[model samples]
Target chain A: MRSKIGLLVVFTIIFIIPTLNYAFAAGDEPGEYLDRRVVIWNLFFRMMVVAFTIGAVVSGTMVWLVWRFRESNPNAKPTKYEETGEW
Target chain B: MSEHGNWAEWVYIGVVCALLVWVGAEAWNVERLVEHVPADAEVIKVTGQQWFWSFEHEDGTKEIGELHVEKGKAYKFEVTSKDVIHSFNIHDYVVLIDAVPGRINIVWFVPDEVGEHEIQCREYCGLLHYNMRAKLYVEEST
Candidate 1:
């Protein structure tokens, strides 16, 4: 249990902290392309980055789950049928 | 669904809560001009008709189809409509305001680029909505 907490803290410091900083830095870099000098552009760029990151993670997880439970794998068998009795 | 899943569940909830806080903070800080408009900001009165846009400057100058503004200067647009509701939209600047009859909507923008930008009606006001268009000319400030 202590090891798990330690791993979470290390993961956050090494990965999550850098990701947060990079996200903020990414927002400032798109000002050159925006037409108006508005802060909304920076926020918009940041939103898009976060949204895309979430979408990629969700889609990747879905793909992995589908592949893991595919019919091709002999170990991936169906659990119980709702219509019939125990088999 | 396991007996020893409390820690993992708590971690998931914590992460979700953090993400929510981050999103809420970003939204709360979104740039919006509610009041205290700069005194030196150029005021442009925009009146939208069924198929045309009219611009009026503080100097009593009227311009149709094209509006000229100085680059690097702040501008506040007092937008309204003559007959129906129309959306005054400048795609490049990401400025959009509803021009409703009997009410004035105010939106502001600072032009940082000098060029001709296309303006169009984003709302379907009438049959000739497709023809309702204008141009914005941003010139270098003197």
Candidate 2:
């Protein structure tokens, strides 16, 4: 379950990053683009890239941690039985 | 003794796959504004002030609070600003254009869905930036 969740996070970031950049960057009038608009769009696109990269890195790290540290038998029955003195 | 007993893992995988597919479909379905705009409609001049928008439609008609257009016709917008840089974004029609000073930005979008749409300033202009907004009313036949 944890692995699946991690994969989901990775996919979501991949899907959202391009659309956000395209929506914010495309469709300016030809030869009339302003420096301010270009600057703002570039900044916003960089921010999105940073955010998605961080999310992907975190999810990937979590997946690796789960693979390395997860219990071998999460639903195992306890075997540390106590002895009765009367018996 | 069972090697594949984690049904929860399968469920999680299914959910994640479904969500990814959904996002992909949504990204694919985003509509473009250029295809909907007409080729031969009148032009409108939009100028953004500090906290208000003033529009000058074709035929020398000046109006505020309401932007009227004839249905089934193409309309072009020449957007600019009076003071600072502002982004003109219409929520429903996928029309987003930057309105800058000393330059005219041309955008063409048709109103196929006749109703009132909200026009907002997407860029952070000034102190009253949050309150800068306007309306676009798509009317039938003039």
iRMSD, per candidate, in listed order: 9.8, 12.5
TM-scores across all candidates? 0.74, 0.51
Instruction: Record all residue pairs in model 1 with backbone atoms less than 3 Å apart, i.e. clashing.
Output: none
Which has the greatest TM-score? 1
CAPRI band of model 2?
incorrect
**TM-score, structure 2 vs. true:** 0.51
Candidate 2 deviant stretches above 4 angstroms: A1-87, B1-38
**Scored by Cα lDDT, where does model 2 land?**
0.71
Local error of candidate 1 at residue B84 (angstroms): 1.1
* Candidate 1 all-Cα RMSD: 8.9
lDDT of 2 by residue, B1-112 (tens): 3355788889878976885665554433332323233446579999987978889977799987557776656677899998999988876766778889999997766566
lDDT of 1 at B17: 92
Worst 10 residues of 2 chain A by lDDT: A29-38
Error of 1 at A31 (Å): 19
**Listed models, DockQ each:** 0.14, 0.04
